[model samples]
Target: MSFLIKNKLGLARTGIIKTAHGNVETPNFAFVATHGFIKSLKEEDYFSLAPELTISNTFHLFVTGKHKEIKKAGGLHKMFPLKNPIMTDSGGFQVFSLGWGKKHNIGKVDKTAKNPACVQPVDKSTRPPARDVSKTTCVAGGVRACLPTGRLEKDRNPVKILSDRVIFTYDGKKFELTPRKSIKIQEDLGADIIFAFDECTSPLHDYEYNKKSLKKTHSWAKECLKAKKKNGQMLYGIVQGGIFENLRKESSSFIGALPFDGFGIGGSFGEKQMEEVIGWALSGLPENKPRHLLGIGAIKDIFIGVGKGIDTFDCVIPTREARHGAVYSMEGRLDIKRGVFEKDKKALDKGCGCFVCSSGIKRKDLRILFKENIPEAQRLATIHNIHFYKKLFGKIREAIDSGKRSNLKKLEKHYKF
Candidate 1:
């Protein structure tokens, strides 16, 4: 795998990531294909959209035992019949999503009205016997402090975190995933690019919690590198530091120094601190390698990430929102299901060339389809939304290639960012 930089404008640049499958343009958006396919869309629908890249979830495939079938079919590309490059993230984000994320009810960004404590203690009944539990101190909110022996005590949280692995109870079945296991699963999936297994911290975590988590993340990165045996797959290390600048820089420096093909900025951030957090995360990475901003794809955040030097990104916003009847446009997102659009005859997006828009689907028509629970509503919306982001990134690459800040400024104004 190789990355060739073709143009640069400040931190933002246009480049190509060469892979066994194909070359993916830098400053691009990788749509989420968690189950080896984009949700609510058929093969023909995706072929029409023809996304540059798609990212699958290692955790989901592994936990659901789908990796076996994927391997049997000669990997994701053969199974999905895709010609574009693919990326598979180490099941690391599940460390947060199934752990603190579920416990605190928060996502990558903390937008809750009330902030929870960084460390909430688990219920006493869930702890081990007094003799065994005495060795470790319980932090507030049920989080157990690492014992002097370097072992972690299980908490009441649905997901259990240990020094060597994570335990998840999904669909009433227990699944254990270690760094080595994560790497093995990615190899079975045979993605062109795979990520090192690192714990994704929550925005609610404090300095001490993140500090300890970083130690585990850094250690796991090394283990992942040692476990990878595939010759063609590119491995990217992940940087995790919650929302702290110092820790973000520390993690970036540690993970960046490793010999991974590229780097991914992971972990959580405050709603308004994404730009600052991204800057800190990229501070110590090698300038020549590609940088991916994990799990972020909002229109405004995409510009922020590109301006701060992120090369690629993956998120479910476009497809997930589309499935709910939200349509993407330069003007803004439109709720096509709303009654206000009952008589509207406007195109999904004026002058857009997406399959749905080019076919001349009217707002009222889409509204009627959605209101009647027709499946085509989601299919059309997903295609339109995916195309919208693909076009946006293409224009961003053009703006960067032109070496004119005014071009990018026009994009922000045009996109209402």
Candidate 2:
């Protein structure tokens, strides 16, 4: 459990994270395999793509009853046939999302966009204002009236937040997930890396409520650390404070002072607050340990994060975007389903050196393959996007090592993100 930096330029560095399965290169991108596998791609597909690491969701695996089977089969890499390392989330995000966010018509991580279908009448006869909406935004009070229709939908079973545990009701049954339970589950379905159970608060939560929740999350962080087993799995303590600067600093100080192997920056926030919030949290953390920025995978965000000292990131964006006919290239995002690409004979990306482009596969052929709705198109598109991300990290690392970090700034303007 050692994170040794090999090179550094400003806060960004190229490092090696020592893990049980293997070493993960720093400033790396982890492919999202939420349900034990990336969508539209099988275990065999990963062998060729060979991501240095993959992130799985604990909530999905536990609810689907796959955790027991995976534990019995040994570990994620062995059970899933992946040669690289694996990291499992504490499922805290789902708890907030399925319960609070759903009830209030808010998204877990997204805040910029609005959903039109989520509009519903505000129920004034329900809960009191103290427990309902706030002055600026409706969190609990007037939630139905204040929010846009596209962001929230009415749901019956959302999670209930208690001081010690989160109650999730699904399919007519209730499941109580405590801090200790989350750690035990992660240990059961062993992965090279695991996260401490903490409350991932929504941005809609006001400062007073976020402050109270921060105290609860801090309590859970200690409980998780105390309950965690030293079975060679690296445990990462998560920092949560919504978007308040003072709370962010406090949460960072509390979580960073702990003896966990690593640290993860968690909680909901808008795009404008990302860099400033991250800077606040990172300022409190020790420079020696690895720091993972949770649930961020956009290219522009990557540049911002790496420059500010984040070591790793995980998101479902690339693969999910690929399934929706979007792929990343050096030029920018390419939509294979576009009518223009139906006859375009050029490669998916002229500057891309991935197998799909390097093998001379034209955009028209790829478009037709994808239009046929075959699995190969999705897989190929996913692979190309992944390769682009991997290469991006590689270039970032190289720029840092060679003392030419300005190249990263240039990429920001070139990509226009």
lDDT of each: 0.85, 0.79
- Who wins the lDDT comparison? 1
Cα lDDT tens digits, model 2, 1-417, are 678999988888889998877888898988998877778776666777788988999988887789889888876876786768889999898867676565555654435322211121223222222333322333223223334333333334457778899887766677888999999989987888999888887655556667888898899999999999757899999998877789999999999999989999988765566788889888788899999999888888888899899999998888899988897876678888999888898878777888788889888998898888877999888888888788888888877788766776665676644
Which parts of model 2 are misplaced by more than 4 Å?
103-105, 108-154
The candidate that achieves the highest TM-score relative to the unseen native structure: 1
Worst 10-residue lDDT window for candidate 2 reads 116-125
Q: Estimate each model's TM-score.
A: 0.90, 0.89
C-alpha RMSD of candidate 2: 4.5
Alpha carbon lDDT at 40, candidate 2: 79
Model 2: clashing residue pairs?
99-159, 105-152, 115-150, 116-150, 118-149, 119-149, 132-140, 132-141, 133-140, 133-141
Error of 1 at 364 (Å): 0.8
Residue range 121-240, candidate 1, lDDT tens digits? 322221222243322333323333222222223445567888888898988899999999999999999999999998898765667778888899999999999999988999999998
After aligning candidate 1 to the native by TM-score, how far in Å is the CA of 149 from where it should be? 31
